[model samples]
Target: MSKATFAGGCFWCIEAAFSSLEGVNQAISGYCGGETDTPSYDAVCSGKTGHAEVVQIDFDDAIISYQDLLTIFFTLHDATQLNRQGNDIGTQYRSAIFYHDTEQQQQAQGYIDALTQDAVFDAPIVTQVTPIDTFHSAEDYHQGYYQQNPSQGYCSMVISPKFNKFKAKFGHKMKP
Candidate 1:
């Protein structure tokens, strides 16, 4: 298994997307690219921990390549929207890829470059490609949140639509 950490707005939405993918063994909502030691969700949400609400994924590389994961991440979130996805605004929501290795870093940068060269969006892509120094796991309440709380307000209104679109676009890539 290989690791990939990404911050594209709420961890809930990111987790929801990757948790359904075929090769993904874990899509854990966590905090990364932060200054604090074991920062709490409230602290991260306060926008002071310098941390983004990230989902750290463990996947089978044989089943799904890092490039494919990057493709899905960019597709699921608005890479041009810096520090926010809809109303979830703050540094905690910034679009970023906390790369685990040199290969991941290079792939992420190359993917962004390709998107830029292809003019995939009118606005420039601002998703940061940074190394993940430490990945702080969030409280247990946050794990599998979308699956457990589908009827919750934020899950219903924010995550459901995005997850539906992801499922529709990548149904062939989903697990049985």
Candidate 2:
């Protein structure tokens, strides 16, 4: 199994996006790209930890390729929007890829470069390709939040719709 880490918007939303995929083994909601070793949700939200809300996913490479994951990552969030995704405005909501190795970094940059050349969006893609630093696991309640609290306000109102659309577009890539 290989791992991929990403921060597109809220960890909740991004986790939901990749957790149920065909190759995914574990989906962890955490904090990365930060100054501190461990940061709380409130601390990160305060915009002082310099962390983006990220999800670390473990997947089988034989079942799904990293390039394919990169494609889904770009599709899930408006990478053109800097330090924010929709109404979740903050550095913690920025688009980023916490690459585990040089290969991952190269692939991410290559993907972004291709998107730019293709003019995938009117604005430039701002997703940062950073090395995986210390990833502090978010509070227990945060892990699998959407799955556990499907009826919660944010899950029901925001994540559900986004996840449904993602499922529609990537259904062929997901598990049964």
Candidate 3:
């Protein structure tokens, strides 16, 4: 299995988006890229821990390529936005792709370059492609938040739109 960490706005939304992919073995919401020892949901949300709300995805390479994952990641969120995605504005909600290996890093940079060259977004892509440092699991309530709390205001209003867009764009690649 290969791993990829991404912070594209809320971790709940990111988790829900990637969890639908066919080759994604698991997508766990967590806190990463911070200085805190063991960040909690509240601490991260407070933005005091400097941790970005991220999703750690485990995938089978035989079923999905890292490049494919990059494509999906770029499409699932507005890479053009910097330090924010929609109303969630904070360092913890920044757009980032945390790669584990050189291959993943190259693929991510390649995808960003291609998208920029193709004029994929009206504005420039501000997505940060960085290396993974540490990932601290979020509180249990945060895990599968969108799936577990579909009717919650944030999930229904914010996350569902992204989920719907992803389904429309990549439904052919979704799990059975």
Best by TM-score: 1
Ten residues in sequence with the least summed lDDT for candidate 2: 13-22
In terms of lDDT, model 3 sits at 0.88
Comparison by lDDT, 2 against 3, better one: 2
Q: Candidate 2 residues 1-176, lDDT tens each? A: 99999999999998988998999998899999899877999999999999999999999999998999999999888999999999999999999999999999999999999999999899988989989999888999999999999999989999999999999999999889
RMSD of each: 0.6, 0.8, 1.0
Clashing residue pairs found in predicted model 2: none
TM-score of 2: 0.97
- Alpha-carbon lDDT, every model: 0.95, 0.93, 0.88
Deviation (Å) of 114 in candidate 2: 0.6
lDDT by residue (86-137, candidate 3, tens digit) is 8888889988988898988898898889888998899998888889998898
- By summed lDDT, the worst window of 10 consecutive residues in model 3 runs over 74-83
Query: Least accurate stretch of 10 residues (summed lDDT) in model 1?
Result: 126-135
